[model samples]
Target: MSIRPTIETRKAVPTMEGAGVHLHRAFGFQDPSELDPFLLFDDFRNEVPEHYMRGFPWHPHRGIETITYVLNGTVEHGDSLGNTGTLGAGDVQWMTAGSGILHQEMPKGNAKGQMHGFQLWGNLPSAQKMTAPRYQDVQAKDIPEVIDDDGTVVRVIVGEFWGKTGPVDGIAADPQYLDISIPPGVKKTFRIDTYRRAFAYVFAGQGAFVDASAPSGVLLEKEVMGQEVNIRDMSGDRTLVRFGTGDEVTVQAGEEGVRFLLISGAPIEEPVAWHGPIVMNTQAELQQAMRDLRNGTFIKPAH
Candidate 1:
């Protein structure tokens, strides 16, 4: 099994969105091809209620799917289709804005006034761009979790892993989203499909994604003889690690352990015409979508 090499590792950038809500963007509004079939990823976490309570007000999305995973707190959401629900801690809501949809998400903090969550936008292929809107709201209990002997825990959120499959399926990207945590001083390797594009976002503790074959100048931290070495190369909190071609990824947890989201998806490799929340294959199609919104025809009649 070839170990995927770390191509780049960078910290998530702070950004504000949706009526003054504060969040950090891992990747978005840049080169979409870097993570094809995936458009944006935002980490919305705050201890101050004022920073996130305003939430994402009513917004329209088309030609894409938005996956919201709540780590703490709750997100009350309502869509144009009359679908309404609340996503609490560990809950996941996958919304497909195939043709079009308008939705609002209001976040509420927990008892300590802390809110944390992630939202990922996945692109829909041209063929299914205008199919139909749908939702897959999976409760925390319905999702599968796998535990290893060495205290490695993995929550399968969107695809199969460790003999367990996620509750949310039928996604166009066929992506695998996993929340993984490793015990301190543990070394582990994960297998990913060779044809898929994969990345890891570290949100807790420090670790080194190691690959002996990693390209020149790629730094990595690893323990030697029970002594932490190359400490400067450790990746910690809110770091985004992008991997090169391979079928496996290896990581060594630091003294405090490490937790991260490991995500991978098949590439769409299609043209993307994007604006705000709407994504299309061509500029003309994007123009048509705007015209539809202007003419009150953005929401297609249910069949």
Candidate 2:
């Protein structure tokens, strides 16, 4: 099996969004070609209430699906369809903005005054872009967690892994999303579909993704019986690792262990004409969407 090589590794950039909520953006709003069928990934984490209290106000989204996973706080959300709910720690909200929808998300920190979460935007193909809006609110208990012999733990949030299926389904991209934690000094490897594009976002501790063929970044080596060795880069918190074509990924945890999100999905490969939240195929179509938004016709009539 071919081992995926780390093509790009970068730290998430600090950004302000949703009425000045502090967050870090791993990748988005630049080029969508490399990460096809996946538009954006954001790491919204803060220990101060002022940093996240503002929250995301009402916003419109079309032709995409948004996945929000809460780690330590609560997110109170409401949509134009009159759907409302609270996403607590470890909860997940998968919203599909097929045709169009307006929604708001407000954050309330835990007792310790900490808020941690992630929001991922997945693209929709041209055919499914305007299907119908829907929501999948998955509680923490519904998601399955697997622990290996070495104490390696993984939580399947979407798609299937290790004979367990995620709570979120009927997604067009067919993505596999997992929350993985490896104990210190442990080594693990995961096999991904050869046809899918995959990436990992590190949020805790440090680890190295070893490429069987060659190392990607700085490595610390040790000598065993006068033999030279190489190691992979120990990527730390808020780091994003984009992998090249392959079917397998190997990682070795550092002294402090590591935790990250491993996500992969099939590429759409269709032309993407995007502006903010509304993604269409052509400039004219984007203009039409804008007109509809302004004219209060973005939401279609019920049958």
Top model number, lDDT: 1
- Report model 1's TM-score to 2 decimal places: 0.96
Instruction: Compose the digit string of candidate 1's lDDT tens values, residues 64-143.
Output: 99999999999999999999999999999999999999999999999999999999999999999998999999999999
Assess each prediction's global lDDT (C-alpha) against the native: 0.92, 0.90
Give one digit per residue, the lDDT tens place, for model 2 in 1-303: 899988888899999999889999999999998888789999999999999998999999999999999999899999999999999999999999998999999999999999999999999999998888999999999999999999999999998898889999999899999999999888789989988999999999988887544544566784322433354476889999999999889988877789999999999998888999999887888898999999999987655
Report lDDT (Cα) of residue 260, candidate 2. 96
Positional deviation of residue 114's Cα in model 2 after best superposition, in angstroms: 0.3
Candidate 1 — what's its lDDT? 0.92
Q: Which residue pairs in candidate 2 have backbone atoms (N, alpha carbon, C) closer than 3 angstroms, thus clashing?
A: none
- Model 2: which ten-residue window has the lowest total lDDT? 222-231
